[model samples]
Every structure is written in structure tokens, then in C-alpha cells.
Target: MKTQSVAIVLHDLRGGGAEKMMVRLANALAEQNTAVTMVLLTEGGVNKAELSSAVKLVELGSPRTLSSVPRLAAYLREAQPDRILSALTHVNVAAALACAMTGMLRRLVVSERNTYSLDKKVNTGAVMKFTYWLAPRIYRRLPNPVIAVSGGVARDLVETESLRPKDIVVAPNPVLTAKVLTMMDEPASHPWLQDPATRVVVAVGRLSHQKGFDTLIRAFAQVADIPNLRLVIFGEGELREELSALVSQLQLTERVDLPGYAANPLAEMKAADLFVLSSRFEGSPNVLVEAMATGVPVLATNCPSGPDEILDQGRLAPLVPVDNVNAMAQALRQCMEQPSDNAELKNRADRYRDALSAQAYSAVLNGSVTVWGR
Candidate 1:
């Protein structure tokens, strides 16, 4: 029998959770003796460190264009991997279309990482909306399977869209607990980690409206009266200037720190006293799972998809309403006053261990399962 090969496609391999998940999956598949290759649509934003040596990195060397699609389709068709898993919605849609155009339909999995509706805001204008509206129809016609990162994401796709429930699979983001533990065990070299007294409240995500760092800033400011508490947001995006302005306007210049994309966020998550997810919406947040793995008590805005589901409907951690500064402040205060048992939280998180998630993905990718969502 010929050795099986799989290609994981993404727009870029920058520091987002979805990108990290792709890297993890690539590494895991490679370790299983599957010939794994990672194809990045853009070259400049690749995070070289996150990927393993076993996995091959193929960069298209530029952003995708109408001209590039045929070239990309040709490349994949020529490679003819046994399976192709595309991460992120836009990339997934593109990969599916490209594969269809090229007539390479062995196994194509489209992973939806965020809540479907937020794509509208992420890409404004009528053209973007039209594309989004057309995406479901286009996706439906493809021979590929759809994978939702969370059950909520799967539900949204099937219930709200024209997609068949049977075609959408929910494979929750895998938690690389061992890797996270190793990173956490290492000494803190970052200047922010040097101080023992600094009460670091960390939020990990791209600096976007969806992640709701602005609301986190507002909540942090309200509780700024608490001495030694510092807010650090990891990850980068277009909202850098806006978030900076908000931090300055709140007069939290001394307290708020925007680290701007830490390649290994688990290090920061482990060192922090608290982890927060203030997203306006999410599909399944890998950061929340990672924080839980680090035994850090998490406080998240009860956003769609990931947080509530990961937190087990607020039984594990505090869930505040989205953009509510007062409620968020109160939640933070409560967390400070009464800390959850780190050991218990870590134990709960261990259930979603990387090995289990890898097995689930392996089963799906290997054609052992038909459907994967609730």
C-alpha cells in the first residue's frame, strides 16, 4: 500500500489560535507516519517556530488572487494528497473550491474556526457580504466535509444555513497539554514575567473587535483600583492602534500591556493569576482550553460557540455578558475574592488532552467516522 499524505492549508501561520491548531495537527499527523505538508497562502506571516521539522512547509509566496487560484488548484491536484484539511473559513472555502476545480476530491475537510456570522464584519462592504452569503451554497456543492471547531459552530452552520447537519463535523480544538506544560516549566525570560509581584491578568487572541479587548480594557480600568494588577493581551491584528488609544484614554498606560503576538502564549497563561476571554463572539477558543490546561482560572464573556461550551456552561469558570463592563468587573472581583481550585480545573482540562483530540481527528481524516457534531 502507498503511504498516505495529507496537506493542511491556511492563509498564514501567524500567531492566531486557529493557526496554532493547524501547526499542532500537522505535527501530530506527521508523527503518525502520515506524510504531512503545510501550505500557507502567504509567505511573510509564517510562524516558523510553531511547526515541527517532520512537516514540510510550502508557501505560495504571495496572497491568493484569481490568477493564483488556478495555480494553487494545479499544485494540489499534482500533489494529490490523500487528504486536505483547510483551516479558517475563507481559506477553507478557497481550498474546497480549488480542489473541486482541479478534480482532486479524495478527502477535503473544511475547518470552521469562528462563529459564521462574524465573517461579515471581518470583511466589510457588499462584495464581502455577497461572498459570505454565497459561501454556504458554494460549500454545499463541494464534495468535501465541513468540520466545526465547536459544537456551537456546527449547530450554527446546520440550523442557520443551507448546509446539511450530516456533512458538518465538530472536532473541538486539541489541547497540547504536554507541550504547554513543558513551556510553562521553563523559566520566565520575558521582562513581564520577571516580576513576582505583578498580578498579571492575561487575555490571548488577535486584537480585534470579536476578541473584545476593548471591553476587557474597560473592565480592567474599572478594577484598576486593585493594586499591582496588570492586563496583558497577547496576539496581534489591525486593532493595535485602537486598543492602544483605549488603554491610554483609560489612563492605564502603566497597567495595561499589549505584548503583540507571543509565539508561545502558554508561557504567559501559566504565569498569570487569571486568564480572560472577552470576545464578542467565538467558535471554539483554543486559548480558553490552553489556560484551563495551565490550571489558570478563566473568566470569559459568555460568547457563542467555544467559551461557554469549554467552560461547561459556566460550571467551571465565570461567564460574563459580552461588552458589559460592570458585569465583567464584578466577575473579575469575584474571581479575585474566590479562586477556583487550580488542580481541579487542570484535571478537568486534561480530559480534552491532545492525544484524544488527535485520535478523533485521525478517525475523521482516515474515514472511520461519518459525522462529528452533537
Candidate 2:
């Protein structure tokens, strides 16, 4: 059988959850002997050299201006891959429009990484809201399927817009269990990890507003009296100043550490006493699963589209309401007081193992299963 070719389209090779997932999927697909290429819309950013060597990387350079759509379309037509899977909304829209014009892509898959309705709350400005409102209509006209990262995301797509259920599919993010397990076995090297007397509580994600790190800081402040507890948030973003100010204002400078982004966060998670997700909203949080894969107890916001489902209704990890600092604090205390069985948590995370998800995605891309309808 001839292997199908897949091209993953993204804005840039940024070190975010969605971008990481795209790289993982591309590599996983390529490992199956399929031709996989990552197509970047922009010329430069952080690149995913972590991807398997078998996968190719292609940058289309900067689009120059909004007027360069024709050039982008021509480039896709020239590449002529069997399938094109796009990661973010702008990239999805661009891929759809480009492929629509060229009619060269046999299958187009758009991965929606956040709750669809949250766009209204996040976009804020009337113009941005209007653009988001028009997304479902534009998405409907595009000649491809939409892949929602979670069931919450799929439901939001149907309820927030006039999108047909037939056009959307739920494909949760997969955890690279083997990589996580391997990293967990390695000795801790981070400065925070070396302190045997300190109890580490960790959160991993982009340091953005949506991550609700502000709320996490406030929650940590309430528990500052907890003996030797240190909060370490791993990831870089634009909100560093704001978060740092909040930490100082709350007199938690000693308790809270914003260590930018760790290339291998699982090692930190393994060394930590607790893992937390303080997002205001999410599509599917990859770190939550990564933490669980490390057999560390997790406490996450019961935000839309990810945590509840990933935690299996709190059986795998404690889920608290979004932005409830008090609840978050209480959950953290409970986790520390009576930690869940690590073996059980690792067992539950098996569902999100990389190989299992790769096989599921391969089945869909290979036409063995109808991915959109379900």
C-alpha cells in the first residue's frame, strides 16, 4: 500500500501545546512510514527539532503581507500533498482558503485548540468578535473537516455557530508516555528539584492570561504558610511582568518561581510533590496528562473542554471550578494531605499514550474510519 502524504500547517514553530502536538503527530505519522512534512506560514520562530528525523520541515517564508495569499495558495498547490492538517485558527483559515483555491489537497483537517465560544470572551473588541462570529460560516464553506481537540470544543462549535455536527470531530491531545516515563527516570537537575527540603507544586503552560497564573498566584498566597512549599510555573509568555508584580504584591516572591519554559517539563513534574493546571479555559491541556503520566497527583481547573474529561471526573486528578482560588487552594491542600495512588494515576493516563492516539489518528487519515461524524 502506498503511504499517504500529510502536511501540517501552522503559523510558526512556537513552543506551545498545540505546536508541540502538531510536531508529535507529524513525527508519529512519519514513523508509520507515511510521508510527513510540517509547513510553516512564517519564516522564523522556535523550531521543533524534537520531531523525529523522518519528518520534514518546510517554511514558506513570511507571507510578506495580507496580499500574499495568492502566493501561499500557489505554494500549497505546488507541494500537492494528499492531506493538509492545520493547527491554529488563522492557519486553519489560511490553509482552507489556499486549498480551496488550488483544489490540490485531498483532505484538509483543522485542529481547533480552544473552546469555540471562549473566543467571544477573549477576542473582546467588536471587530474581533465579528471576525470570530464569521469563523463558523467561513469554516463551513472550506473544503475540509474540523478537528476539535476535546468533546467540549466540539459541542462549543455546534452551539456557538451554525456549524453542522457532521463537520466536526473530537481528537484529544495524546501524551508521549514513553518520553515522559524516560524523563521521569532521569535524575533531577533543576535548582528547584535539587532542594530535598522543599515541596514543589508545579504548573506548566504558556505564561498567558488564559492560563490564570494570576489566580494560581493568589491561591498560592493563601497557602503560603504551608511549610517549605514552593510554586514553580514553567513556560514563557507576555505576562511575566504582571505575574511577577502579583507575586511581589502578595509577598510570595519566595514562594513562587516563574522559571520561563523548561524544554523537558516532565522531569520537573516527576520531581514535584504536586501538579496543577490553573487555566481559565482550555481545549486540551497536554501538561496535565504529562503530569499524570509521571504518576504525580494533579489538581486542575474544571475548565471547558479538557480537564474534566482528562481527569475522568476527578478520579484521576482533582478538578475545581475555574478561577476559584479558594477551591484551588483547598484541592492543593487535599492532594498534599492524602495523595492519590500514583500507580492508579499512571494507569488511567494510559488512554492518552502516544502510540494509542497515533494509531487512532492514522486510522482516520488512512480512511479506515469516519472521523468527522463521531
**On residues 211-269, what C-alpha lDDT tens digit does candidate 1 reach at each position?**
89998999999898888888889888889999999999999999999978675678788
| Candidate 2 lDDT, 44-95, residue by residue in tens | 5564666778988887776532234566687777888877788776666677
- Local error of candidate 2 at residue 331 (angstroms): 1.1
Off by over 4 Å in 2: 1-3, 64-68, 123-131, 142-144, 369-374
Evaluated with TM-score, which candidate comes out highest? 2
Kindly give the stretch of ten consecutive residues in candidate 1 with the minimal lDDT sum.
62-71
